[model samples]
Target chain A: MKRNILLLLVIFVGIGFLLHAWPSFSQEGEEEAGYPTYPIIFTKPLKAVLFDHKVHVEKAGLSCEDCHEDIFKMEAGSTQQNEDFNMDSLYKGKYCGVCHNGEMAFASNTRCASCHIGVMGYERLLKKQHSSESSSEH
Target chain B: MFKGFADWVKSLKNEGVEHIASEERRAFLKLGLVITGVYAGGKLLSVVSRVREVYADIPEYVDKYPYKPHYSMVLRTDRCIDCQLCMEACRKTNHVPPYGWRTRILEQHLPSGEGQWTRRFMPILCNHCNEPPCVRACPTRATYKDPETGIVKVNVKKCIGCKTCMAACPYDMRYFNEEKRAIDKCDFCWESRLSKGKFPTACAKACPAGVRIFGDLADPNSRVYQLVHDPYRAIWVLRPSMGARPNVFYTIN
Candidate 1:
């Protein structure tokens, strides 16, 4: 009975360790896992803005730690919830402007069209997503 | 008879020559303009003088560019935010690979009174020099300057991927394209857009900020010409000591 209890305790300890390491693994936010795969869209300035995690993190060689829990929360679209998540804030070197102010990366004030896809592009992207989903279902 | 002919030639020269002092050229010009304005509605004279004022720095009144339309770019460095839309646009328009870039933005850390205003962005591309070192370095004559537009172009078919031109470039703008088996760099979006009768390059059009001013440097009416020729504006080129005579001009404004 003592041996069985010890085995049970070991199993519990193993599970607990796995749980502790879980957040760090997810923190990387690699697209291979397929969580947060789509572009995060912001629609405050009447024009839709797109933040592509894959492009910045993967293509541009940025780390998840570069933004997560510091500049932005790990929760997707958490930035849009903040009142200061606007162009004015960006110009002042807050949020995206932290690196994008022509220092670490491209400035937030410049390249407005690349990120600000406008309502038309947003709708087109929505249509595309819908079409792809419907096609996958078929 | 020879003396009479010589005197007649001298008199012919003197007829057109205004005896008015050279220092009073501006006054003469103003007076002539007023007379022409009164007689020929003055509109033509005013326009001509304005154009002359803009182009007074250029010595060649007839033609500054040997090429018909000399393609050039002027970058307003202060306005760049480093958003890299120009880089993305170039990649998309030129079908550039992920590893390569025809144009890139550089970040400059300027010491400021306040630390908040310390960063600046500079956009860089192929200079397309008057005396292009890449053109001289090309063994197979793959890279050559277009006489018509004065654009340095790569004849990809002839390029053996030697990377000699890449080394020759002072700005380090060229890259070896494994797919094309040639040295690839910014052709100012010539094949993708300019040949299709496009006015400005893809990068210039894509920039949200009015940073890249692309136009014919030879044309007095062009924005590039006006910006570069402006005595008031502090215009400069990268690595002037190289003596490439780069066509691309950079300024704060």
Candidate 2:
């Protein structure tokens, strides 16, 4: 009876530990899926724009292969270096327009604020990052 | 036998529409009354008797030009990206301190749809109102609307720094300049640029997106006049209910 009770106690403790560590374990799993867990922020050509890998990958059901090596380079923000990487280019079925052509997703011209978070958003993001960093340090 | 008519009526069950379900009541009420919502107290309910009309009429000051070169600005609100280049240019040209701002961008997250929101940046500055509340509120006559250009200006020498004008301003555009020891606000870059024969304000010139269109409102050919006068375009000023008669207008292109 004591041995059975010890086994049950061990199982209950294991379950409790798993429950406690679940969030961090899931976060690690997301990172291991080969995409950055944090939203990628672009600052070039404008103050800022936000791109979420999770939104495109999980929500929109897009794979890395869909955008990689063709529409966008494997390296992030590489498209921004090009002079043609702008709204005009997007309207002409290039870059973001490849998918965001009103059919696949919302057109680039229609919902501008969705991506263009602007200077204020950029500053807010910086503040958030700073706060998170300080908190983690503590 | 019944005692009387009053006593007989009182004896009957007091069944009114009060016991009806809210959904059934709403269905009945939907015919004439537009029920807005039930308030927290549960006693207070709001109903819109008539459909609120969208801005269908032209602005009051379409043809009226009181000042000779009535300086005005029309912001194409949708075009603004909140890059803040205009703010930087204004600061550099006008020597605005870090603590103070003659112009600033406001960020808003407007509800786009159910469980969704969209971000927008609105740039605001001194409206240079036709009937400036700040001018009327000034005890020392330090702030005045210029008769020549219609630009509201502050006379720093006359200013006692009472900040009455700051409080009176409907737009909340005025801020105290600690260095000057006076309440400072945007004069449409008149002291720095416009008086120097420069057509547009520093902020207007610096905007890469062509968001700010500054021109003489009196001139029929000017872009500002055309944009404001466009019958199809919905031109609106901030806080129109305040009736400050703001010269600055906002529109989306």
- Best of the candidates, lDDT: 2
Per-model TM-score, in order, reads 0.54, 0.77
Per-candidate DockQ values are: 0.02, 0.43
- For candidate 1, write residues B1-253 as lDDT tens digits: 9999767544442222233345545675654332122112221122133333322254522245677689989998877755667888899999999988798877665665765435566889999988899999999999999989889999988999999999999999999887887889999889999999986999999986689999988888999888888877767778867868788888885
**Candidate 2 residue runs with Cα over 4 Å from true position:** A1-29, A32-34, B1-59
Candidate 1, residues A2-41: lDDT per residue as tens digits?
A: 9999999999999888776665564456546433667788
The local lDDT score (0 to 100) that residue B18 gets in candidate 1 is 36
Q: Please estimate how well model 1 matches the true structure, expressed as its whole-model Cα lDDT.
A: 0.76
Restricted to chain B, the TM-score per model reads 0.74, 0.78
